[model samples]
Target: MEVCFVVGRNGAGKSQYLIDQAKGNNQDSLYLCNTVHDRSQELKTSKRFSVKNTGSHPNNVMKSVIKKMMREGTHRLHQIEKILLYCGYASHITVTMRAGKIDSRLDDFSDTSSIKKLTEMIDNYFNGEDEISFNVNFGETSDISSLSKLENLLHQEKPLRHYGMVKAIEISLYKNNGEPVPLLNASSGELSLMTSLIFVLGEISGTNMILIDEPENSLHPRWQREYTSMLCSLIEYHEVKVIIATHSPLIVTGAQLDERVSSSIYHPATGNLEFSSSTNIEELLWGQFEIISPKSRFLSEKLAEKLEELSAHKVSLNQSIEFIDSASKASFDDGQQDIFIAARQLADSIARG
Candidate 1:
């Protein structure tokens, strides 16, 4: 499997790159864009699934899973079950007061009929009923023993035990306090992660390429670090190539930490994507992505010059103090000002020594 990590700032043509690659690739491909809504129409591929359409509707996603299972066979049922457990599916109908009148909307996507069918299938298979069979021509035969083992593992992980409850006509995920949290009510990060994983794993097979834009969006720093490794593992399982475009340093560094995956940065100024050997986040920010703002860059250069002068003994202590004071006088925003202040203190200490 070929795994490529593309890191760059906004408007670095990351999305365009993925689009072009998907268009050019002769083999089957799946393009998942978190930023764009309903891009599947523009991309003109049934294999491509975006968060906008599919992520909002859990019933629709479950329906897709059932269809895939029918076509691909029951061997993948464990993966399907895992995704279903993680994805938030229950939604509550809500009402609002407007001008002394009531306005109500139904946010729930639960299809009782479909849920019943899915639950029946699961129950029959797990109960070791010989009447049910989900084998198809897609590939391997159904592995009930392996599926049983995975089901046990998933149960042990506590995600299923903690978050999910499966029923004959309904399945709902609850929060730690035992209140049900629907997908729509779930955090943006959680929704994105679950939806992306579902679509990717559901349609990964028989495809040579996968293009994902900004998978790190709305994810926590820890999740961002694990994002690349997770995708690489999935890609390897499917035996497909994947191109990921992201702005997160954690995502880039995470890929670097994984020896199995390859990482690169797209330099917008140079119009080239180059392999990055430097693991330093500072080097990545400045050299590869050019993420430093002009004002911050100016301040950084000024601080470096002042520190150099102090080290070389080319300026008096008083002069160095004056320089530092003048530099700090410049108005800077929160992070930039903090950096300038730290630089001033460091330079002051060096000059005094």
Candidate 2:
């Protein structure tokens, strides 16, 4: 598995670069975006490519992939269980397939002993308050008998609505205490992580190339830090080249320098730059992110405007100095002392003039 981490500020052509790559090598390639403005939609003409619609619910794609795999007798129960567990949604997942509705029945109440045992069971069940049972159901919409037609529908943006011969995919997620977890109660980050994992480890497995844009969109900082490793562990066995575009420093540290390609770098040969984990985060911000100061952009812009106005004599030196002093003091933080000090020095020079 070869991973390329593309880092850059917003609108630096990161997503477009991925789109172009996918278009050029549309065959056996998968393009995914975790953004509403999915650029991969531009690749609609390329039928050989697997492109995800960021606007649609991720479950649509997940269900389709599960059906396709199920038809091939390759169950991803373990993989889905790992994804749910990693996202903190469940401790385990039980996948069951059935052609008809799934039903559960308690033993017939034949005697007093059986009734007493049932009462005890109910009491024990209620006692395990720490656990919950979550059910996720996937059923066929249309019963298409042909595998070729099933594959065609699975490739669509929404596969569940169309008719298919795929069996229902029922998964029950539970906690360590053996209680089910209501997967619908999961946070956006948990859902996003699970979706991305399923998308990668499911139908897109063994792909020639995988392009992911802004996978950190709904992920927490901790998940973002561990995201790269989790993804790699799932797909390391596959012969695939992965390209991830992100703005997170935590994600950047997940890959080595040779694996990182910055959009800010311009070279015909390569964009790889050494990104040592030993380097301080501040240097990463300054050099890689081009952040000159810890000050907010609003404050920096105001300071620049004040300096320009003072130089043009549009305001009194005392007024300008006082404004800069107050603004600097208001936005001051421990790490931004140097920025205020520089502003003060520039104000002093203007006052002396």
Model 1 lDDT per residue over 59-172, tens place: 345435444654565656456444334333322111110111111211243555643443444454446432222221112344455444333322332222221222111223
After superposition, the stretches of candidate 2 with alpha carbons farther than 4 Å from their true spots are 45-56, 74-76, 91-172, 257-284, 290-353
| Poorly placed runs, candidate 1 (over 4 Å) | 37-40, 54-56, 80-171, 174-185, 287-346, 349-353
> Candidate 1 vs. truth: CA RMSD?
12.0
lDDT of 2 at 318: 80
Compare the candidates by lDDT and give the number of the best one: 1
- How many residue pairs clash per model? 0, 7
Local lDDT at 17 for model 1: 75
Assess the local accuracy of residue 311 in candidate 1 as a C-alpha lDDT between 0 and 100.
81
In candidate 1, residue 94 scores what lDDT? Answer: 14
